[model samples]
Target: MAEDVQINWGKVKNIFESVTERMGQNPDRPAIGAPKAKVRVIKERLFEAKAEGHTFQIDEPVERGGNGLAPSPMAYFTAGAAACLTSHITQSAGFLETHYTSLEVEATVLWDNRRKFSIADLAQASLGIIYNIHMESDEPEDKLIALLKHAEDGCYASDVVRNETPLRAHLIVNGDEMYVHKNGAEIPDVPAGPTFGDNPTGMSKDEIAAKKRDGG
Candidate 1:
């Protein structure tokens, strides 16, 4: 449990699926189905959320006519990439008994949608990560390459994106958390949040919206 970690990067692959697993229901008691998570675009590109607790918020800069108060949702692209890279580095560094002084992950969304530069059409994935890394002492170039490959191979997100996986997302206009799976149970909409388009003062809007918009 030291700061340095170097483990088989593939080992961490299971982490993502486990963290994002959804509750699968058996309608027919002994029925079977897939073990996939659900995603719902809460409000335009403004917010794309899921029950798994990860959120992708679309923000615009001042020049884009938006308030610029929020960070661009695509920026989370970098964040997600970094988190995955960090996990790989941590696991790898631990097993290798090495560490990185600085780790910087960057993701550049390449917009290839000639029809319309829509965020949904744009691709989001980890471009790469630079780890100012080294062993307790200097290591050979070949050894470093091996470690880098380990990090690359350990990136589960990359694998999933490179090899497109079947996507299934459920959109709930007004789903409620109290009755997420309960039929005929729906949450109500109170007054709008504090300001325009914002949630209430002390209430979780996602929870509210999940109830009010997506309905319970």
Candidate 2:
């Protein structure tokens, strides 16, 4: 049998209560955070991204003109939304002192790619996302439903998809400001940087092993 997952309800409840109390004292208090990611293209349809001290690679499938070395950007986006909802559900359950044997969340993203490839002008690229929650618990059905509702309301990723969020895009070419979508203006181009060389051939197995052995 698999070991049961454990959570400290007392700690969870205390955290929620403390945050609520703080917010109640200052209703207009702003809690803003900006997470940043630096991405660089490695080759066609392949990129490396560094965020929060972690680095990861993103690539498209072989059919999409990539080497199929990693998951695509859409995969990460879908996973982020699903994971956010699952996190909220788990945290809310702990806060409410609800018990559960297992919890699983499955997500499906319906998308149209006609506009992406400039083949046709579509109404929207993302049709919708469906999330299915499979949870095993002895709790009352009403309680479970309430928990789901709370999680849906609190999930930021779900809100982003459901609401119209303004996006400001800017393009910088070779360290020169090229365009700003917010103002719908193109800036005068400056001297361009040095042209890029051929794509790098990564280390071989022997070199990688030697580096590992040398603690590099």
Q: CA lDDT of each candidate?
A: 0.48, 0.76
Cα lDDT of model 2 by residue, 13-49, tens digit? 6756666665567577443334568989999899999
Model 1 TM-score, 2 decimals: 0.46
Leading candidate by TM-score:
2
Give the alpha carbon lDDT tens digit for every residue of 1-216 in model 1.
235434443434433233223212323322122222344444443444444355444556766655555576556555666567656656565455454434444554443444254545434433444334333435566665665677768776565555545543334556733323423334333333243112212245577677667543
- All-Cα superposition RMSD per candidate: 14.1, 11.5
Q: Which ten-residue region of model 1 has the weakest summed lDDT?
A: 26-35
Candidate 2 segments whose C-alpha is farther than 4 A from its true place: 1-3, 183-216
**What residue runs in model 1 are displaced by over 4 Å at the alpha carbon?**
1-58, 117-137, 173-216
